[model samples]
Target: MSQAEASQLLGLAGKYRPYPEYKGAGVEWVGDVPEHWRVGRLGSFGYFIAGCGFPHEDQGRQDEIYPFYKVSDTNHVGNEKYLSKADNYVSKDIASKLGARICSAGDYVSQGRGCVAWKQEANSYSGNSDNKCDTHG
Candidate 1:
């Protein structure tokens, strides 16, 4: 598995079409939001976690029980905005040895490092990311 430099992982969100229906957001910065959508500080919902080091030697076993995603996994053909697959996988044993945790089915995984993760939150965690990732719990 190849690792992308943290610097190379920073990305701007692509443009999305306006929601079909809208309602007042009651917030100045965001004038309106899709109907039925809740607007609140993202922190109120979940925490951003730090990525752990995944040694190259423990990567690439398709027989493993978990998928190990690298920043580049974000760019995989089917993962334009969400990770659908990974080039590498790991067993629970290897993940435990690396002090890594797997984000559950709905959790978010990003390429941002600790210092910039919060700032990238708004752009990083939006859709339902079905794929779990190995991170430091």
Candidate 2:
């Protein structure tokens, strides 16, 4: 939509005002949102949990393969068309120590820091391998 039309639709030029000087690329309105929309912080919208690094001692032992996910895995899922395989795998014990964050089908995972700009998508573990559940949404 045109800038003027969007502004009118959003009530940005009535009692509300727009900044003539642009500081960034997004549309910034100077008034509250419609009654239906609520404002809140990221913490209020959803829980933020940090991912932990598996210790070197827990690297690989060939006991029970556990899915080990990283930021690159997320990128692999994109454009690959088919299900992407995890490059790393750990033991069940290590996965257990990592605990609750080990991830499961339908869990949302994020790469934590460097790849924060990517969109989050819910993932499902449908592969036969038990070590394929570390997906981020």
Best by lDDT: 1
Worst 10 residues of 1 by lDDT: 114-123
TM-scores across all candidates? 0.53, 0.44
lDDT of 2 by residue, 1-137 (tens): 65567778987767656444433233255333444444565466656444565555654444345546545554464413322355456655555566525444454444343211111123432222222222343
Across 1-137, the per-residue lDDT of candidate 1 in tens digits comes to 11122224543223334457888778765666679898788666667565567667876677776666666566667666645566677767776787666665445555542111111112233232333332322
Deviation (Å) of 86 in candidate 2: 0.7
Q: What C-alpha lDDT, on a 0 to 100 scale, does residue 67 get in candidate 2?
A: 49
Score candidate 2 by lDDT.
0.44
Relative to the unseen true structure, what is the C-alpha lDDT of residue 94 in candidate 2, on a scale of 0 to 100?
58
| Per-candidate local distance difference test | 0.53, 0.44
Query: After best superposition, candidate 1 residue 82: deviation in angstroms?
Result: 2.5
